[model samples]
Target: MPAAPEMPWLPAQLNALLAQQGHALLLEGPSGLGQFALAMGWAKALLCEAHALGTPLAPACGVCESCHAVQVHTHPDLLVLLPEAMQLDLGWSSADTDSASEAKRKPSQEIRVEAMRKMITFCQRTDARGRGKVVVVYPAESMNTVTANALLKTLEEPPGNSRFVLATEASHRLLPTIRSRCHSWKMAWPADAEIHAWLSAGHSTAEQVQGAMQASGGRPQNAWELLQSGFEPQAWSQLPRQLLQGQAGLLAAASPSQTIAVLQQLCHDVMAMVVGAVPRYFSQDSLKPLVAHLGAQTGETITQQLQQGGQSPRQRTLERLAQWSVDLQQAQRTSEHPFAPELMLTALLDQASQALQAKR
Candidate 1:
């Protein structure tokens, strides 16, 4: 696959690091934010003896034997470690067995310690092509405590000819000692205008376009996912009305995935309203009924529930309120059951109602 386009600032940041021969580098950002691509390119540049991108100060020679091997991913000097599975469970639900089968899924456990040990061993090997060795750890935080501990010694002091490139969305989850040992760079997401333009490349109504951008948190790739899934923003505009006006039809019509999404969206709107932030996903019209029926407290309660529900029992909750707050995002994305969306929504509504009654 072609490399993900580099973030405008990344080339310069990476180039500076490649100039220095011995520094370990950490590239941190959200998943799918081009960190993997940047790391691959960096590895290639490093192993490249003919490093075309290299200047007098840096070591990578793009046209060299080492670079060619890296470009084809056969470089003896580079080892790439990726997730065994994309989604991790983190103990988000006790009934994951049912949820898994219902959604045709499996929860991802932590990165096995064996993977880290293998990486460490690879890094210690002498370079086959007579160049510095590179180890690129994708989703670096996938390392569990044990695996991370296993990696600490290697990360702190790798062989003189070895360099490491680590990537992650959950930077804070990494050991602080591991974090402090490497040079870190942050990659920012694209702007709203950029995402909007990309989504509108195909014919889309103003509202439809706006809604996708909202659903995606301003990421073009995410906006594309929402669009491809046939999530109609115009249709969802009626949700608040159905909730507030006592339309059992609307509640009955939703599927589990849809319910999960709408309830999460509703909860998000309430939180936004309370904080005086502009809620781009839900309109002012929808917000009126939501604020009236659920109120700010109910919204906050549901938001807290969703956030708490997704965390490990011992871990604290996340501060943000997102409609896709549940760990079931990938499950929902791939599920084909017609009733799944409705069931998920109904469960949320029932939970919200119970919370509302308890509040009273």
Candidate 2:
């Protein structure tokens, strides 16, 4: 197999993790920080025959059969547990079970108890290769109470040389027992310069790289995904003014959830601007023209008025924006529900326009 493209920030972390001793490791960090990639890297390194025979701290040799198996997702001694929806998204095939019934149901977003049961069974079995067995559970918070409890005992007392890696974007959502049974490692955030260099090495142009870095808040994985998705940085910068002008067509192709996520970022930046802070996901120039309508009060004045609970025009606008943010959160909770895409887009646009135009 060929060598995998480097993440620029994971190799050192992987080597550091390899030096540690633990039966179970919990990789926790915010979304888009490459938790899954780091977890998989650890698993591959552990199962690499060369690493097993050579230096324990060395990374997996890509030419090894074990490394190839991992690359192809056919490792006999390794198991990856992911929700059905995520499996589909990542191009991994779910286990073959009741094909007719599965075809009738939508892919699940939560790791089911059945998958946990299978993982427990996998843990009990002997390692196909002498390198030992590894079980990787990604987005570990996807395991609900029942599923989490099913694996708790095994996590507490693993059979044979079995090892486990549980990766999560939201560690707080995991049960305390699950969290306590493993050694936790926080994923590192790469600097913007590193991220920019990495993105530029790919097909992204210099301008696209800059836009993607800002759009993804300097997260490399997300910036790469944004570049791949064909969402122009110019469009993103203009989104606030477009929303204020009641333009819903810009997001017409997006799902309700995707649209809501974009709106949430916009809302977050607008709120930051209202209080005189830097915008995170969009450029200040793009947002400044739109927020200029809020009048001449400085951010300090707005903060003072808000502190005193005064009802100034900026305060009223801030209040409206807060309510809009709450509404967007509520919408996100049900954004996956089946709805007419056009109707949902129009309604969301109207809501956003009203909130952006609020000045009373």
| Pairs in steric clash, model 2 | none
Candidate that would win on lDDT: 2
Report how far off residue 214 is in candidate 2 (Å).
0.9
Q: Where in model 2 is the C-alpha error above 4 Å?
A: 1-4, 52-57, 95-98, 296-310, 358-360
| Model 2 C-alpha lDDT versus the unseen true structure | 0.84
Write model 1 residue lDDT over 7-98, tens digit each, in one string.
Answer: 45356666676666445778887654567767777777767666333344353556767767666656677887665454221112223235
**What is candidate 1's local distance difference test score?**
0.62
RMSD to the hidden true structure, all candidates: 9.5, 3.8
Please report the TM-score between candidate 2 and the true structure: 0.90
Candidates in order have lDDT scores of 0.62, 0.84
